[model samples]
Target chain A: MNESAPNPGDRIPPDELIDALFDGELSPRARREVLGAVRHDARAGADLERTARVLAALRAPPEAPDLTDRILHSADHRRRFVPGRLRRMTKLARAGVVVLALVVMLGVAAGRRAWPEATTLADEQTPLADVNEAFRDDAAAGVGAIRSSVHQVRMSFQAISTADPCVARLEIEAAPPHARMLTAGFVTNPFGIEDERADAPASIRCGAPRIGAGPTIWVGSNPLDPARPAAPDDTP
Target chain B: MLRSEEHKLIREAARGDQEAAASIIRHHQQSLYAYMLRMSGRPDVAEDIVQEAFVRVLTNLDRFDFRYRFSTWLFTIARRLYLNAIAKHRPAYDTDMVGSWKSSAASPEAPVEADEQQEARRDTLQAALLTLPPDQREVVILFHQHDWPIALIARHLDMPEGTVKSHLHRGRKRLRTHIEVAPSSGDALAESLA
Candidate 1:
């Protein structure tokens, strides 16, 4: 490097002076004299030249920020706002959806309340009659309805073991002239002879229970059908 | 003069204005970014470092002393960040890399065009400087770039003036060898030596 250059900031010479030389930091008189020697001195000349070039380049700007582009990409926003009115709109929409859902659920609840008795008629009655009925009674009161006609019908029986096989509570419902009927009685298609002879009662007929302040109406039955069906007696 | 108004904005920001905080970034970003990029030799890394430094400065604006120039303070922050980055990404410099740089690839007399061309010149210099040992490169840059008195360079670097000189002499000598052999770098090197 700069061999024997006053041993660089020492008692031998001021450290600051040598540093000044390296940085071209000297005042005019000193700079001229120091530079003169360096020029004459082959080694010092080359040293100063390279030193100057490096310095000049360093003084130039470093790569200008490509950061703006990258920061925007990373943060996913070119600009940030105050989170103002848009936030209010989002909250309003979410509240509206929740309210709509609640209203629909409430409507369904009201409908179920109005028609309570009709909802569960299927479960209380086990296998109902497979009646071969050719009768239609358009009655004012009904709980639930499933009607099918057969020429000959058979219903396998599971007797209660103690009660009469022919007896069940019968509910006959009609319009204003008659109030609803709630009665317990015996029903017999006796003899187990596999007959469809009694079409007069129009197969196994039923109606709603008695009307009351409480909201409910249903009919109950004990099943009795033979294993098979034979010809109807009313055919003639 | 005020590092382009960031110090003023920082004061306003510290006084509880959120908008002031934004103003500080806008004002100081370009110059600070330029400084960091020159200091750190990687363009991509330099970008990240500058943004982070600005954010940090904004957050800690209250801690700044009133006496010092804001650019000096900002630069000190930039330098510290640059050093930390160098440590984290401490690359093993293969000596072969020093060969390709070969001083000035662009002719000193080449017609200057875009501002980016000037930037490329600095980046090239930064790359070459990184080829030097850290001690020599720092002294060399401080000396030539600032042309500061040795006392200032010494204070700035926190090294003794003697050490600054040693680094200067040795760094300049090493650089001279490359420049003499460098193509198109003729006059700048010649003028410096003269």
Candidate 2:
């Protein structure tokens, strides 16, 4: 025996060394020393036996209850436990659908605002033929004929007279593309000849006598001023 | 189960395959249940922890890390749940009732005397384990019971391997003393007879 090796009778093995021996963690030399110490020491032998018994009992498999059905059933009842990827995908799909609906709705609203339906004053008011006939008859019958025969034309002039001048001007300016047809008819200067000039101030003339043979009325051109009877010289 | 096979099942389960989820549960539930049963020493608590752990794992299957073993992740989740359960209600273990369920399911092939002896030993072991500190008890159970390596237990418990080994050594020594002092059922029977 080497003098460097501690004699087993010198002292009992430490609990750590004994545990390491049982755990198979000790080197072969350490194992031999521990076993030699344990053999020489009855207390160490009993301690080893107790540890072996405890470890054996612990290693023995415990009866595991079969809980497969219960766990699966409980999991199902608690929630539709979809996996993360599928759940995220489902959420994305729902959000995509909502976004698509909003986009379509906004697109339709913008399209309606950008391109509206066509509406003309002729469509809403009296037919152009009737107005021309009334104008022609009134011109032939002179100033007295304007009150009786030109009923529609008188009503149109009265409407323009009572209405906001700016609103009436906007209506004329906003007329549909086909409004140029009105100027080509017998009622040649229905609103007044000077009113046709872009630079001319807005005005209305009601029952004013014509400059020559026709019963044309050339009212004054200042819209802000009150409507007055036209002087024959004002016909230009 | 093989690692490759387990990964395949995990993928299927994440895709919402009920059968795959069931297979995963069937493969792991018993060992997990045994672990919790030993840890809590209450059948009902064990059952509850096992069910809750599976529910949590299956619900968040996509978050699982593939590099680690599925069992490691599962046991980690179960350990957390057990700790939470303990914090909420520190159960007083009924040693007599600890393994009573096993008695009914005991194998017919085993001799009656040996089975009773085995049951007695298991009860004594569980009672002794309950006497240890939580960390020591966990190290002991994971090491001796589950046959986990010291390195794995160290990783699982988030401690150093040396600390884990220290706990295991101390836990085993304490368990031995507790078992030696506690009166076995056989001894009680002998005393009654005498």
Candidate 3:
């Protein structure tokens, strides 16, 4: 305690000092000093008393209804979407991928016909029609014995008459037995690579159609092609 | 200083332990509810905010830094939720209310209600508290109602000690002014203050 600390006999302390004392900010010596002053001075005593009264009344509210159950329930519900538990969804997605891949293999093995020798088309609007026409004609040739075990379908193209760099769009369509046609498209820089293969598992997994209709692919100019006039390359 | 066991409970609660979550709620619910009741001036609203705060606290436990008190983090989240609720729906602080819905902690004598005078005084103080700006009201509520130390309050509000002290001082000044002039056609003054 400070020797100079005021006694209870002293007058009321300043308001800031009283506030600090109430707030528990005063040091021990200062607190003792303020307490001593507040004890004897009637006004200071009332002020301190009033402040304490207010603080106590704040606690008078009855206990709130227990919320632990509700909170826990909400949390448990939300945990499903939390990233940490996303592995559950990942497991489901993986199962779906496996099923889709199986469907693709079955479809490719059961319905694939010996397609007419591969057709190469130049990047032109008219050749795009020719490409589609060629795919239809080949599918019309009818199905044959499926020999290959490997399920990869490779589409190779070498652009011959393009002035600027160009890309080719290849759409692989499979008509599964009773379901709608499933189609997947790929864009290729024909100048850079001779061919691009769309894996059976991935291209087939794009849609879950039945597994009976054979797969036919139509190769054309980049659908986003600006101007096209050259005839398609017809090499086998 | 909190017990080591309480910290353990926090860690366990963060790991999805239901018992730990219950313990944490039981430990802080009273103080938390009272604080919200004082801040929001409604028992229903206070309860809802507390429930919402607990959900947020439990869900975000991984992000909670152990450097600070758990109660501080809990209250910080509760405060933000209440503010957001207020922003969406400004609640009415009405008159002649009973139960736990008072903005300012009333003078203790209000409970006993020895006479009509004491009751009126309590009402006036509540009205005065409503007149305070939210910043000042929050400081006052945290300091007086919750017995929070100035330093802890500074940390909770992310403000300097001087600022917290300033808000407390101004808040107390306003309360004093309201209580002193509550009688004799002071409704206008109270409205202007609000």
Best by lDDT: 2
Give the worst 10-residue stretch by lDDT in candidate 2 chain B: B185-194
State the TM-score of the second chain for every model.
0.66, 0.84, 0.76
lDDT tens readout by residue for model 1, A117-176: 754355543333322121223331232221111101111122212322322212111111
Candidate 2: residue B5 Cα off by (Å): 2.0
lDDT of 2 by residue, A23-127 (tens): 667777877777787788787786776677667666666677777777767777754657667767987999999999999999877877776553212355457
Per residue, candidate 1 scores C-alpha lDDT tens digits across B103-124 of 2324567665533354344434
Q: Over the true interface residues, superposed, what is the Cα RMSD of model 3?
A: 7.3
**Model 3: share of true interface contacts reproduced:** 0.33
lDDT of 3: 0.61
* Cα lDDT for residue A82, candidate 1: 26
lDDT of each: 0.50, 0.69, 0.61
Model 3, span B76-101: residue lDDT tens: 99999988888877645343333344
Which one wins on TM-score? 2
**After best superposition, candidate 3 residue A19: deviation in angstroms?**
2.0
Give the distance in Å from residue A35's predicted Cα in candidate 2 to where it truly belongs.
3.0
Stretches of candidate 3 off by over 4 Å are: A1-11, A27-29, A32-41, A59-62, A80-236, B1-3, B91-128, B182-194
Among residues 3 or more apart in sequence or in different chains, the pairs in candidate 1 whose N, CA or C atoms overlap within 3 Å are A9-A15, A166-A187, A167-A186
Query: How good is the docking of model 3, by CAPRI class?
Result: incorrect
* Candidate 2 runs further than 4 Å off: A1-11, A78-236, B91-104, B107-115, B183-194
